[model samples]
Target: MKIDENVCWGIIGCGDVTELKSGPAFQKVEDSSLVAVMRRNEEKVKDFAERHHVKKWTTNASEIINDKSINAIYIATPPSTHLQYALQVLKANKNVYLEKPMVLNSIEAKILSDALKQSRSKLTIAHYRRVLPVFLTVKELLESNVIGHVSLAEITIHQSKSANLIAKIADNWRTNPTISGGGYFHDIGPHQIDLMVHYFGEVDTIIAVDLEKNTVSNDVVKGFVQFKNGIQFKGNWDFNAEEDKDNCTIYGMKGTISFSFYGDEIIIFLKGKQERYQFKNPMHVQQPMIEKTVGYFLGKNVNPCSIHEAAVVTQIMDVFCGIN
Candidate 1:
């Protein structure tokens, strides 16, 4: 079922990711507008509303969720609050644009899945990169077999403890396992893993282990994914490394394709020739996905990213962190 109406949005957490990455896209998308925003900090929320030209701001999340005018709610809060707020939004008959790692664990994913089944509203996970041009091009190249019969893939992300790649928050909740799930792996792995699942199909088996354990979170995580398509993927994430490095390479019978998940360039190598492709992300990185989401919300198109697709990523992270 579709809304058949303009998508009026209420932001549940107006934090760093919303400043430019996604907040403005709600208004920029056709037939969609950000009507209100909510944050625990009254001052910050008010400031954000005034600066963004939004009409309403609140310190209470319920105010935004219960607002009759808000037909959709974007939950940008940490992983811990995702289930509570998402359940409430669905119960209120409001559509949801949930942030990634959809839930902390498979248990929460199941609970949310059940709620979605009983609700009339729709939910889309924020695995926004799949819609970006660079990734789409990579998907196309792989589909065309530009890299021949794919056999193996490697994903390596090594960053120093103070890596700028890691978003800095006041409370540092991202490193808190109870809040962000595992650690840097849980926070960043979903984006890469979701793309893997998007590029490949489903997972056949997965095995992961933590290399360095800390009270807050794991500093290093290594995992292997075996896809049913007969492709094997090995991934390693190190938060306490000597330097910063981010790249994923897919090897095939003919050559290989290498690219960075957070960057705009894609490179393909075949024998002696090397081809490069570059893309410029929109000023608002999430705008493209937001446009797609708006279209899906109004029944103009199919869901871009579904809860089930995102649940698979969470399940992978669970294994990576030795949760089960």
Candidate 2:
């Protein structure tokens, strides 16, 4: 693929994620340039633009979307605003790189999907796990049948409340159902679910046991999903736990594959031996996502997670949230 060397980029929201990691990634990616940024807070927008050396900053999101100079727009805002912002950008004929849990519900997902179909602009969701080296290795190993005929898989994610920034924000968007859809599950579960579907193919059925009282989310949740390939998966998310563990184990007839998110490494046990694979440091996984998304937009590659896959994920999450 020939690099265009002239891809101008704009960030829709200058939030913590953009400032800490994604902003730098956009600037660092080859053939990509961060030209503009938008935020509701004028001072924050100006500060971010100055700090990042962006050419333009505005509080009006439409300015970035409608700007003919910008070829791609990154929607780093919350899930609730994703659909609207994406549609507006698509309408303006700008490529979109949206954050995960693409929208609050499947309906919004469909709306965005339909808009993308009509517009010349392309869409890519921020499922960063797909581009991570360790996870990519896992995908390769599974494809190679290292774990012959995966039968069952389990994923457990535990995090301390002390580290939860969303919990500390007064009237945080993440806690509000209108903004974030649900709580922890909707916020972070998309990564796990997307990875599961990415490896195992489409899910045939899903049954969720959400323990929260007000339809937000519980400290613990257990879900069972059956994939079309007859692979059964059990997933759990525990937010109120003291010790943190983010790992997934896939079992098969021949061997097993295990991975830890914190370590960014994979462990494989096969044929009476165990081996480990470690990924590179300064693991800016988002860079790959940005590159691929740009490729997809420029008709160089396919959108890895299509609307159908995103809709399936939304359906499963809705069932988990007990939303009809």
Candidate 3:
């Protein structure tokens, strides 16, 4: 297959995330351009295009997928539409930058997997946290044995009904199971799960439970993950909690390291001493991953995150929510 020399990009869902987290980075990356953007709302999409300096805007996704000038398509739509739009892009022979929680469920992932077998187009999941400096530092510490013989990881992600951590969206589709696949956990858990698998290894077994299942969405969940490498993970997520708290701590034989997934600092404790590492996120938090994705689409680097790896996250969440 001939590699595309430059990645002319098109965005399928130019929503709030695109405003600063991702849309601008496409223009900032070398050999990449944000040529077009699409949203169901013509006014919003046109406004986004004008503000971002993109030349084209549309309400129809087919325009972006079928545009020959666009070698890569970024699909940031909700989880329910990921599989459909991704299949269309692949059929058009265009590379895809798919958002995380890759599909509504594992069944959709199976369908996407089958479609991928017949297409030469490449697809990368947006588990963007993998490329962040704070996460990279955590990986480095584990590799360097800064926290020796790591045995366990404990997580707490408690938030009230109106926590600021949850993205503000109209109609709150993120909390609707039919649209987001699960609940708030489904919306944000993919990154946490992906990071764990990235740092520890493949999952060996999963035991989880949710407080409610008959409702429109399940908000409270408890899960335990046992990685093949002997590292264990225990977590609790309560969207109806009274306060907001986000923390993850890894315990090891020599010491312990703790940090918040949404924060910019890592604290380490050992031998009666403590060390803290801080980081500042870029204006476009997703730029690092987008740059890597552009290189990957142009045949310069490997995929930042693959569909198969991302499926594990959905699969794990399925068990956590008792949907598997």
RMSD for each model, in Å, please? 1.9, 2.6, 1.9
**Residue 72's C-alpha lDDT in candidate 2?**
87
Better of 2 and 3 by TM-score: 3
Q: CA lDDT of 75 in candidate 2?
A: 94
Query: Any residue pairs clashing in model 1, and if so which?
Result: none
Off by over 4 Å in 2: 1-5, 163-171, 210-215, 281-283
lDDT of 3 by residue, 1-324 (tens): 122678888999999889989999999998888889999998889898888888999999998988878888999998999999999999998989999789998899999988988999988998999999899999998899997999999889999977898887767889888889878888888899899888887999998755353244767888899999899998888888999999999999999999999999999998869999999888899999999998888789998898888888888888888876
Reference-based TM-score of each model: 0.96, 0.92, 0.96
Q: After superposition, how far is residue 117 of candidate 2 from its true place, in Å?
A: 1.9
Question: For model 2, how does the per-residue alpha-carbon lDDT over 164-238 read when each residue is reduced to its tens digit?
Answer: 523365546776777888777787888888888888887898987654533465456678899988999888877
Deviation in angstroms for 203 in model 2? 1.7
Better of 2 and 3 by lDDT: 3
Q: After superposition, how far is residue 253 of candidate 1 from its true place, in Å?
A: 1.1
Candidates ranked, most accurate by lDDT first: 1, 3, 2
* Cand. 2 Cα-lDDT: 0.81
Superposition TM-score, candidate 3 onto the true structure: 0.96
